[model samples]
Target: MTVAVLFALFTVLLIVGVPIAFAMGLSAVTVVLMFMNVPLVLLPQRFFSSLDSFPLMAIPLFILAGNLMNVSGITAAIVRFASALIGHIRGGLAQVNIATSLMFSGISGSAAADVAAVGSMLLPAMKKEGYKPEWSAVITAASAILGPILPPSLLMVLYGAMTGQSIGTLFLAGILPGLVIALFLMALTWWKADTIGGQKHSRATKAEIGRAFLAALPALVLPVLIIGGIQSGVFTATEAGVLAVVYALLYGFVTGKLGPGLAWHHLRDAAIATSSILIILGGAALFSWIIAREGFPAQIAEALTTLTSNPYLALGLIVVALLILGMFVETISALILVTPMLAPIGAAYGIDPIHFAIVTIISVLLGSITPPVAIILILACRIGGVDYAKVIRPFIPYFLIILAGLVVITYVPAVTLAVPRLFAGYGG
Candidate 1:
């Protein structure tokens, strides 16, 4: 009865078009008030505690770093680099879109930021080269979702903070699958590029290639600094974020693009983005407490184990469930609510939490590109000035390509564990 009421409230609020954060808070409060005798004071406590997490500090910094990279002209350099590498291919600019996302993903970690940065540049170029606006928008949208699954990803940081998993390991786990998705998306784009051969392929001059590489060099160094710092134990994940911000500022200054006033503007933007995420997180934490206090976790664990003792089967079910939940709830909210419950079940079945974290984060990220409530896709639609349905139609191939990559990362534990194992050798 309690579980039913909880879900009922959640569904009703969602259907009514409440913002996800408020809906989560309202449903949680309604359920808590209805199901138990807990005092209202606890709501404030949970809200504060959720944002109080030290590790969560990474979220804003990562978001800021991605935004700074976009504003500081890092994205442009990387796009040029991608263009030089893939522009001579059959479907050149289309191929460049995927490759550019893959490169930028390592730096930014925010999918919406990825689309905003990469889409603005690539969409216009692709259109000028004679590709349909719809196809151009769709392809770029599909490619941008890659950022949240790649290293330095904001989603991974949120997953780690909410679930208490190792952030470094999750970051490492993203590498192989990120690359695999990049390769497959590039192939798909190549096929499409072949079909639409309006642009003349040009091999970049040696000087042009050198100039692009040099231009991208500062931005490319950010991922290395971050991942390397974490892997080497030189800095905690939180500190790596601080380093990212400092590096971005320094790069901006050195390039003469960031003056005294520009630094303040970037800082202001970072604070706003950070506050938005933290506010949602606070609401989610309150909701998570309600669900947990109502015994959802225990009930779920018992039900899952009873239904199928097989770890693989249980994992498959959990993946499908998360994917579906993702279509409605925002990714961070889903992780905050579900990770606390499902992670322990994974542990009970001998699954590594780090492995589960990678799969879970990646699975949730798939939602950002999925239909109905795809946040990144919506951003792309607005930026490219295309209709959502038109954007979604040609996106099927790229979706399947990414889905294939997700399945590979999910079932094959080694794809996730290899880097962590090699770097730290702690997973034995």
Candidate 2:
């Protein structure tokens, strides 16, 4: 009854256009007041308790690092390097868009930052260079999702925080899966070159390729620094986030790119972004507490026993339900609401936590590029000045390839588990 009221009220709030964070908080509060005997103080206590974790500090640190990188001009250097490697190919800009996202993902760990950073530079250039604006928008949005699938992922960090998994192991787990998505997207770009409408560039000479790589080298080293430091016990994930910020600042100083006023603006922007995520984190924490208090996970597990005792079917059903739920709720909000419930259920069925985490993050992230609440797609269209309707047709092939990738990562646990198991001793 409590779960029913909580979900029903949350659905109503969402349909009526309340912001997700507030919606979560309000629904949880209403359910508690009406059904539970706990005092109202539990609300604020749970909310702050969620934010009080030391590991959670990585959230804002990463956001600030990404912001600093943008203001310091690392994004363009990465794009230049991507262009040199693949700009001669058919659908060159689209290929470069994917490549740039692969590299940028290592730094930002966010699809929004990737789309904004890479799209801001490449989208206009692709449009001016004769690529259809709609195609440009579709490709940019598609590749941007790699940000979270790669190491240093903001999504993975949150998942680890919520689920009590090792964040370093989770970071390791993302590497191969991230590469697979980037490679497949590049292949799809080549196959769809004719439809994408971009001109090919002359292949760069070896010297040009070396120079571009040199230019982007500093930016490229961030992921290695983070993963190496974490795996070697040199730092916690939170400390690694500190290192990322320090590195970005050092690069800015050496390049003379970041200045006082610019730094202030970027810092302010990062703070605003961080505040939004933290609020959502807080609200979801309260909601999760209420649900757990009701023994929801056991009920869900018991209910699933009737549906099927087969773990594979259980996992499949969860994925499909998440896919549908994602089409409506924003990815992070949906992740927070469900992960606290589903993760334990996954363990109850004997799924590996790392594999489950990867599958769950990637599955929810698809929402960012999908409809009704396609945040990444909307950002891409807005950046390129293309109408959203124009990109829907162009988006279909990329979406299908993404779905195929998700299916592989879902059923074939090795696809995501190999690196973490090898390096971080995961599942041992």
Candidate 3:
């Protein structure tokens, strides 16, 4: 009855369009006041304690690194490099849109940031080149999903912080699956070149390709630096974030692009972005405490295990639930609310933690591209000056493509486990 009341209030708040942070915090507070014997002060304590994680520090640093990269001209370099590499292919701009997101995803770690940085540049270019605004907008938003799939992922950080999975292992786990998923999108774009109104250009000269790579070299180095530094024991995951920020600022100053005023502006922007995520997590912490106090995770795990001894069937059920939850809730908040409950369920089914974590993240990220709560998609729509209704149609094919990719990654553990295993003795 208490669980029913708790979720009932949360659903009502969401249906009425309260911000997720307030909705979660309010629902938990209401439930505690009515039924739970927990002191009122304990509610706020849960909120603050959840934010007190060491691994969680990576959240803002990674966000700031991604932001600084977007603003300090590195994003343009990445776009240029992506264009040089594949913009001459069939549906060239569409290919570049995916490539730029794939490259930028490693830095920004946030889907909205990917949409803002990459979409701001490519959505206009694609539209100006005779591609439909709806198509351009959908592609930009869909590709932005790569941000959380690839390394330096904000979602993975939260999952690891909450569930105690290895952050570095999750980062490594995303590598092959991330690239393969990008290939899946690229292939779809290539096959549907005519559908998207693609244009082809002559292949770049060797010299032109070389020049673009050289220009984008610094941005590329940062990902390698973080991964290599962490893998080699030079730094922990949180420290790698610090390394990323210091490197971005230094690169900006050296290029004379990130002056004091510009740096402050970007800092303010990243802080705002970071604060929003932290606020949602705080609210989730309160809700999660109530859920924990009620033994919801154990109950859900017992029910799931009793229903299905088969791991794949269990995963499919969880995926379906997550997919449905994602359409209504924002991605990160949904992640926080569920990871605690889901991780134990996966363990009961004998799924590898690393594999389970990646699959969980990919499924949740689909929400960012889906409607009602399509946070990233909303950004692309605004950038392209198109209405939400217009893009949803074009989003269908990409949605199907992403779904197919998810199926492959879900069924084949090797797709996710291989790279992580080779790199760090993570489960195979």
Candidate 4:
């Protein structure tokens, strides 16, 4: 009865267009008021408690680091480097688009930021190179999802905090899966190069490649600093975020790309973005608390186990459910809401938490390109000036490629676990 009431009210609120945080808060409160004897004060308590973790401090810092990097002109450097490396391909700009996203993913940790920074810069160039606007938008949106799948990922931090998994292991786990997805996207771009018909350049000269790599080397080293610092026991994940911000500030100042005014503006923007995410998280935390109190996670695990004792079958069902849920819910909201319920179930099926974390992140991220709430896709379309309807058709192939990569990551734990095991000697 409590679960039904909570979910029913949540559905009604979503349909009525209340903001997600408030919708979750109201639903949880309403259920508690009517059915449970819990004090209303517990709602506020849970909200504060949810945001109290040290690991969660990484969220705002990473957002700020991404914003600072954008203002500091690091993105242009990375793009130039990517272009030098891959611009000779048949679909030159399209290949560069994927490569740049793969590089930018290390810094931004947010797909929306990836689309805004990379898409805004590359989509116009792609159009001028005679690529279709819809295809340009599709590639930009599709590749940007890699941002959250790579190290320094915001979703991975949230997952770690919620599941009590190591953030370092999650970061390490994402490395290969992200590369696999990037390779798949690049392969698709290469295969369709003739159909896309973009201007191709000669392979970059050795001197040209060296110059671009040197220019972008500062930006390129950020992922190593973050992942390496954490894995080497030099800092905690939260401390790594501090290092990221300090590094971004120093780099921006030295490069002269970020003046006081621009720095202040970017800081304010990061604050607003962080506040929005944390609010959703606080509400989802309360909602999760209510669900857990009712033994909902165990019940879900039991029900899923009854349906299929096969671990592979259980994974398939969870992936399908996540993809479906991703279309409706915001990715962070979905992550916070589902991780608590599903992680335990996944464990019961003998799934590695690290493997499950990568699968869950990738699965939810696919929604950023799908319809209704395709945030990354919408950003790309708006930037590229392409019709959303036109881009969806071109988006299908890339989506399938990414979906195939997700399946490989799901079934082959080594794809997600190898790096972590190699570095830390612990798979989970």
Candidate 5:
């Protein structure tokens, strides 16, 4: 009864267009007042405790680091390096789009940031080079999904804080899966190059390549500094985030890209972004507590196991559900609302939490490109001056490519776990 009311009211609030955080808080409070005997004070208390986590400090720090890098002109350097290596391919600019996102993903772990930073720069160039606006926007949106799947990912940090899993292990686990998605996008770009009709550049000379690499080398070393430090036990994920900020600031100053005025502006922007995410998190945490108190996780686990004892089949169902949910809910909101419910079910079926974490994060990310709530896609389209409807047709093939990659990551544990095993001697 409590479970039904909880979801029923929550769904109603969503349909009525209440903000996600408010809907979660209101639904949880209503469920408590009417169905459970729990004190109302628990709601606010749980909300506060949820935001009190030290691991969560990584989200804002990573956000700030990514922003600092963007303001410091690191993104242009990475793009130049990627172009030198692959800009002569059939779909040269398209390939560069994928490669730059892959490189940028290491620094900025937000898909929206990826689209804004890379898409804004590349979209106009692609259009001027004879590529259709829709194709340019579609490719930009598709490649940006790589942002959250790479190491130093904000999504991975949030998943770790919520599930009590090792953030370092999760970061390590993300490497291959992120690369797999990038490869798929690149393959699709290569095959569709002639159809898309983009300008191709001359192959970069050794001198040009060397120069670009030299320019990007400092930015390229950030992921190593972060992942290496974490894997070597030199810092926790939260401390690594602090280091990332310090590194970004130092690099900015050394390069003369960030002056005091620019630094202050970026810092202010980061704080605003951080505040938005933390509020959603706090509300979701309270909702999570209410669900847990009602034994929802155990019920969900029992129900799923009864439906199918096979872990693969169970995961397939979850993938389908997440894809659908992704179309409606914001990714982080969906993660907070669903992870607590699904993690237990995965465990019951003998799935490793880290493996499940990788799958879950990717699934929600797919939502960022899908319709109705395709925030990243919308941003790309707006930037490219293309209609959202026009981009949909071109987006279908890229979407399938990413979906296939997600399936491979889901079924082949090694794709997600090998790096973690190699680095930490733990395979999840």
Candidate 6:
């Protein structure tokens, strides 16, 4: 009765256009008043307690760092470098979009940030280069989904916090699968370029290549610093985020790309973005607390265990259920709402927390690229000046390719576990 009431109210509020954060808060409150014995005074305490975690400090700092890089002209340099490297290929600008995401993913860890940083620069170029604007939008959005799977991912941070998994292990384990997704996207872009040939570019001289690399180096350095600091035990994830902000600011100013005015504007934007995420996180935390206090997680866990004693079957169900839920809810919201309930069941199966985190992150990522709640896709379309319908069609094949990648990573735990194990072994 408690879970049902919570679900029905949340669904109705969402359908009625309430913001997801408020919807979660209201629904949780409703559930408490209707079904639970808890008092209303507990709400404020729960909300505040959610934000009290040290690790969650990374969320705002990373968001600020990403927005700062955008305003500081770091984004432009990386796009230029990507274009110089891939712009001579058959689907030059398209490849540039994928490459740029791969680069920015290390720094920002948010797919929406990836689209904003890289898409704003590349989408126009692809349109001007005779590529269909809609196709350009589709590919850019599709490729940006790789952002979450890459290191420094906010999803990884959330996963770690919820599951008690090591953030360092999640970061290290993500590198290879992220690379595989990039390579596959590149190949798909090449084939699409062949089918719809655009204006091609002349090969660049070695001097030009060197200049582009030098120009792109600063943008490239932020991710390495964050990931390295975490893996080397020099900083916790939260500390790494603080360092990322400092590094982005220093790089922007030293490069003469970020002046006081742009820095101020960036700070404003970052605050708004960070606040949005934090609100959602806070609300979901309250909601999850209510559900847990009602003993819903334990109830659901027992039911799931009864259905399947086999770990593989349970994990498979998790992936499928997440994919379905992803269709309705946004990825970040899905992660917050589901991970609390599922993590314990996964542990009972002897599943590595890091491996479970990878599957959880990737499954939610798949949802971010699909219909009904594709925030990245919508943002890409807005920036690219293309209709949503036209852009979505071309994404079908690329989406399937990415789905295949997700499936393999879901079942083959080694792909997700190898890097973390090796890194831990070497560290020891």
| Candidate 1 vs candidate 5, lDDT winner | 5
- What are the per-residue Cα lDDT tens digits for candidate 4 across 209-257? 9999998897899999999999899999999999988999999999998
**Pairs of residues clashing in candidate 6:** none
Error of 3 at 245 (Å): 0.9
Task: Give the poorly placed runs of model 1, Cα more than 4 Å off.
Answer: 196-198, 205-207
Ranking by TM-score: 4, 5, 2, 3, 1, 6
Total clashes in model 5, counting residue pairs 3 or more apart in sequence or in different chains = 0
lDDT against the true structure, each candidate: 0.82, 0.89, 0.88, 0.91, 0.90, 0.83
Q: List the residue pairs that clash in candidate 5.
A: none
Residue-level lDDT tens digits of model 1 in 357-405: 8788777778667888888788877887878888766878878888888
Worst 10 residues of 4 by lDDT: 367-376
Question: Tens-digit lDDT track for model 6 on 1-428?
Answer: 77888989999999999988999999998888877786788898888877677887788788888887777787788888887887898788888889989988877789988998888888877777788887888888888987888888889888887666777778888988898888888888888886644688888888888898898787787777877788888999999989988888998898788888987887788778768777887889878887787788788778888998888888888888888888788888889888888887777788877788888888888887788777788999999888888866787898888888887887888888778777665221
Give the residue spans of candidate 5 off by over 4 A.
none
Instruction: Report lDDT (Cα) of residue 12, candidate 4.
Output: 98
* Per-residue accuracy of model 3 over 310-397 as CA lDDT, tens digit each: 8999999998888888887789889988987788889878899989999999999886578877888888999989999988788898
- List TM-score per model, in order: 0.94, 0.98, 0.97, 0.98, 0.98, 0.94
Q: lDDT at 379 for candidate 1?
A: 80
Better of 2 and 3 by TM-score: 2
Model 3's C-alpha root-mean-square deviation from the true structure amounts to 1.4
Give a tens-digit lDDT track for model 2, residues 1-428.
Answer: 99989989988998899999999999999998899998888789899989887887898889889889977889999999999998998779899999999999999999999999999999989988889899899999999999988989888888999988999999998998888888888889999999889787999999999999999998899999999999999999999999998899888878999877877787788788878889999989888998898899989988997899998899888888888888888888888889999998999998898888988888888866888779899999999999998888888899889888888888888998889878877763
- Cα lDDT tens digits, model 5, 1-428, are 88788889899999999989888888888888998887778778888988899999898899989999987889999999999999998899999999999999999998999999999899988898999889999999999999999988999998999889999999999999999999999999999998887887999999999999999887789988999999999999999999999999998999898988988888888888888778888878878887888898898888888988889999989999999999999888888889888898888889988999999999999987999879889999999999888988898999999999999999999999899999899945
Measured on C-alpha atoms, candidate 6 has an lDDT of 0.83
Residue 13 displacement (Å), model 5: 1.5
